[model samples]
Target: MDFEQGSINISDDVLKEIAFRSFIEVLAPDEKDVKKLKKSIEIERTPDDNVIVYVRTVAPYGQSLVEFGKKIMKNISENIQRMTELQVSAVNVTITDVVEKIETTEEEE
Candidate 1:
């Protein structure tokens, strides 16, 4: 937004936070997952002032990586654009690992 005096700028940290929160909302991650996510989200600002988001994460072993990546990309891009009113040049999702969903027995729960 622009005013007579100046314009409001969203910082890279804020953008990063939004991206992080957006990922959590989509994934509904657990405690262990949250820790991993904290280190995996990064924000890059382009010369033209657009933003690029890079996310490295683990996916469920049986899920399709392509569709999974697209899901994450869409969510991150929409969130950053909506919250900051800034263009997202790209949302690059790199699948770092694939883990199986561990199911606990009734007695262990």
Candidate 2:
């Protein structure tokens, strides 16, 4: 009896896609109707195949910046490693902007 192991190789674009999906899932889950705030993201790799992902995102104002940052890092690193089965060296998250949550102005009857 013979058994074979299969492997999957993803391109750089795939890496970017995965990183974006992961970020949006954790960070921008509520931004479905609205376009994704993350304008740019990338997955960098070392010569030895180590993975490093960078994400630039927008955050809602009046939130805990420290906690938010931690969540982004964890989500990106874990999601990528979980989905791709690759050793993620690190996940660097950058908050490019903070948009104030607009209050709904309903007219009084």
Candidate 3:
């Protein structure tokens, strides 16, 4: 008797979802905000099974550097679990730029 099985592969949608969730969880933005935040957040996989995440957050940066790193790792772990078969060796997060925070006016507040 012979048994057949297939290996699991990570899909692009999963990667994008993971990236978006990670950003939202890390940033914790308010829903009523007028201006759009998070200019761009990208996730890419390297040939060596490494995940790279790039984030651009609105400034003045509220979250601490340490917290940011922790969130990235947490999100990666969660995503890996959801995917089941894909194993991530490491996750690297790079903050590309900081956008100025929008000042709230009296009426907006």
Better of 1 and 2 by TM-score: 1
lDDT of 1 by residue, 56-106 (tens): 777777889898889889999998898888999999997766768522222
- Clash count, candidate 3: 0
Candidate 2 local lDDT, 17-102, one digit each (tens): 77777766766545442244334677789887879988766667898877887887888788778887778898887776666852
Ranking by TM-score: 1, 2, 3
Backbone clash numbers for all candidates listed: 0, 0, 0
| Alpha-carbon runs more than 4 Å astray in model 2 | 1-7, 29-39, 102-109
lDDT of 3 by residue, 1-109 (tens): 1226755566656665666666566566666552343335555677865556564444335656667666766786567556544555556555544445533233323
The models' CA-based lDDT, in order, is 0.80, 0.68, 0.55
How high a TM-score does candidate 3 get?
0.54
TM-score for each model: 0.85, 0.73, 0.54
